[model samples]
Target: MSAADFLPRSSLSSLIDLLQQQGYRVVGPQVIDGAILYRPLQQADQLPAGIEQIQQPGQYRLIRTQGPRLFSWANGPQALKPLTFAPRETLWRSHLQADGSLRFEEVIETTEPTAVLGVRGCDLAALSLQDQHFSGDPYYQQRRDSLLLIAVDCSHPADTCFCASTGDGPDARAGYDLALVELDDGYRIRAGSPKGQSLMDNLPLDAATPEQQQQTDEQHQKACQQQRHLPAFEPSRLIHQGQHPIWDSLAEACLSCGNCTSVCPSCFCFSESEVPELDGTTSGHQRQWDSCFSEGHSYIHGHRFRPDTKSRYRQWLTHKFGSWVEQYGRSGCTGCGRCISWCPVGIDPLEALTELGREDVE
Candidate 1:
């Protein structure tokens, strides 16, 4: 098939079961504490349905929708980065015996294949960034190769998003195994790769008509038009404006809370720690997620490379927009507005960059 075939919503449910039966753990978004969190789902019933989240400069709220759609909403605060880079986990264990010999324990490898459903476009991009960082090195090849992605088209966008500007937005254009576009009564299901095709083949969905294809195209356009928030910065030109004074202004109001990094999908930096066992003689070495905004993040012998908030913020933005291309061959940000909406002071990256007049430096 040419990928225009539409699938019944019920077929999606069945396909999830089929994947589970095939030994792939199915994961999707579910509402928890008024926020969407991804967890293992046995069936599609657990999927968030008819719920649209209202997100703005500094807040997020869940609102009921008039229609029944699973993926008809803006990006949420939670990004999928932690699933691969684990927020906090023990790397290994060690013990000091009575003989004063130090013994080391081995770290077990995670070997599970996951099927992620309802992933947004920005999240997809974030995953792509992580893949480059993890898989590009021999250290993370096994974990990266075992995961599968199933992305959904965004029919709605938040007030603080401008993914359209970065060309990442409102839809999953690539980096997805299967891409689904929600219709009035069904879904326009299409396979981006062989794994997606295998899932479609196991289900019974209606073949998409020319009219449906047209609607899908039109709907995607309309979704992009509905967004009202985003920065005016042209991502391609960020390199030229790297040293601009605009970053200083944005850092003044910033509290350096690290909330944005915590919720970001592409922020993969981590820190290691050691925890002592009950016996006080044994300890485990653990690693936890660390943010560039943190004080101790750039700590050295007695100095911090990025002691100033302004410098740290600029460093983060530059790495995401400028240096990431050199490191991963792509921008680190997927245009997920979690950083904007979750900011207590309403720190919009787009607005900050534009205010600096760095939007079109190229």
Candidate 2:
């Protein structure tokens, strides 16, 4: 309901273990290949404890510091979407016997109540956008029912990030069970949901001091000031620019490699394949992440839809920034800038949108 503070880093590990004891799998940022990745963390020390990442076009690396603060790093190479919507899974399985008896089995649903520790604000917004697409729809309730989110403030942001302009963050606003703003010595923890309240009720914590509250406020203000500071565009106005020539021009440099969509925290498109046995009597279906940019993704009635790279690129950006709100009632881009940083051709979405804005003025 409100915020609290904890002084002990050792207790933080205990808290994680306590959550694990309560059957919640603790998911937090860990170091992998010089990048921060969301994975199961057994102790607070296992987290990229005091490491931050420096990111730029075609560059990403980690730098270490003294202290046990989390959220020290910037966003990672992979987005958060695949955590719930797994990139690869079996949809269902089929079996056929020699007697020609056919049977189909639906996969059993299994979910570990996940505690997402140190989720970045941009990722939180991406989850919000995904909620509209999945949880907002009645069909996706099953998946939404399983996650427990714990978001952390962005003490540091990369050069390419523009989430602040999008009203999503340098700090998380909603859709978290608990929100943490890290301090040099401790954490100012805010409970964002009843689930968090229940957990904190058992923990040894006290009401935040006025000074601690001020630190939280000041930390957020500083983070807001340090953003990439890209120009703002209203989400509602995105659609009106669909016919603008900026899409075609930007497509020229796009490799149509789908690198942007793949690394985006909100992109959820996928494809299905049938794994048939040698006897051809049985097969199981496998689901894998797919993108609109792939050539084989367009087969329809023996013909490809949106065959050209220009059209494919246009379709992706248009849906992500322009029409996604109408289609899913949310902004597709989370302002994560993974797309901008990870794109093979280094095409910047904000720059592209700004160019379109310039055309409107001209």
Candidate 3:
């Protein structure tokens, strides 16, 4: 617990200006479609002010706050994944050559540099996992390399959140350049990298007092205590539990709509498409986010491995909690609980795990 620096609430907007001066498109939360959405933030006023989200399993609502608070909600539907790993992207395009040959070129987007403000600890953990998954992906690198991360601590954890159990956050622990804890009147900022240090040096900030630092720590502890959590289960259990009847129960209630994967910050399954012109001389290839629950995902040359809803659900659960550890040396889930909140059936993955792990499940 090093002494932190304080940034007055009013001067917070100046930090946005500093990032903008460095040619970074500052993105933060905004009220959109009756909920908070992360988008390009131009001014501080554009932040979701005087509003907070009340979230539970399969339910989300907004409430007018008694006071001014920019980021009171735990999360929106979107996470850092969409910002780095595109939902749909043109990977490459091939054209018919003049000499009856073909040529191919990669399609990498050259967009403005981005500074993600208000990143959560769980999302940061998810990004690190994705970095390993997409290490060789040029498009992902293109979006990730020039970006700066400024994480805001969750002072108010949602009922659906479980970052404490996941050890990812009630506050940012790693992978962020700068981490901020919001107070009633200002923010207590800490540096996690050289870029954060450099940015810290130039900002119009004051040294934080011991009382302010204590307040930040208290709020962080309170958030961890408030958020819901999952029962502890070893990663290896998920591998053996694949054949359990719990998967069948999950399938019965499951819609297989792929909503869980889309909302999960760490899910990285994708499918590619190729289109040809009428002349069949030129072709276009693109990639999009895919879910294991999708029927086509299990298809290979007209044979589907997990055709049934039960098997498909099993695949997603196993990959996320079991085989993922073997493949990547880490569990894929960060415990942000977006899956539970966004799932149409309100089917919580933890409940499935608990059911499958029971002594009688086998």
lDDT of each: 0.79, 0.76, 0.86
What is the full ranking by lDDT, best candidate first? 3, 1, 2
Q: In angstroms, how far off is 108's CA in candidate 1?
A: 2.3
- Cα error of candidate 3 at position 35, Å: 1.8
Instruction: Please give the lDDT score for candidate 3.
Output: 0.86
- Alpha-carbon RMSD to native, per candidate: 2.7, 2.6, 1.7
- Each prediction's TM-score versus the true structure: 0.90, 0.90, 0.96
* TM-score between model 2 and native: 0.90
Query: In candidate 3, what are the lDDT values of residues 3-50, reduced to their tens digit?
Result: 448999999998999999988889988888888778889999898777
Q: Candidate 1: misplaced stretches above 4 Å?
A: 1-4, 136-142, 228-245, 358-362
On lDDT, the leading prediction is: 3
Candidate 3 off by > 4 Å: 1-4, 277-280, 360-362
Q: Alpha-carbon error at 254 in model 3, in Å?
A: 0.3
| Candidate of highest TM-score | 3
Q: Write the per-residue lDDT of candidate 2 for residues 59-123, one digit (tens) a residue.
A: 67789988577667668976567776777877778999778898998764666677778887788
Q: Per-residue lDDT tens digits of candidate 1, residues 106-170? A: 67577698888888887877877787677654325555666788888888887777777567878
Model 2: lDDT to the true structure: 0.76
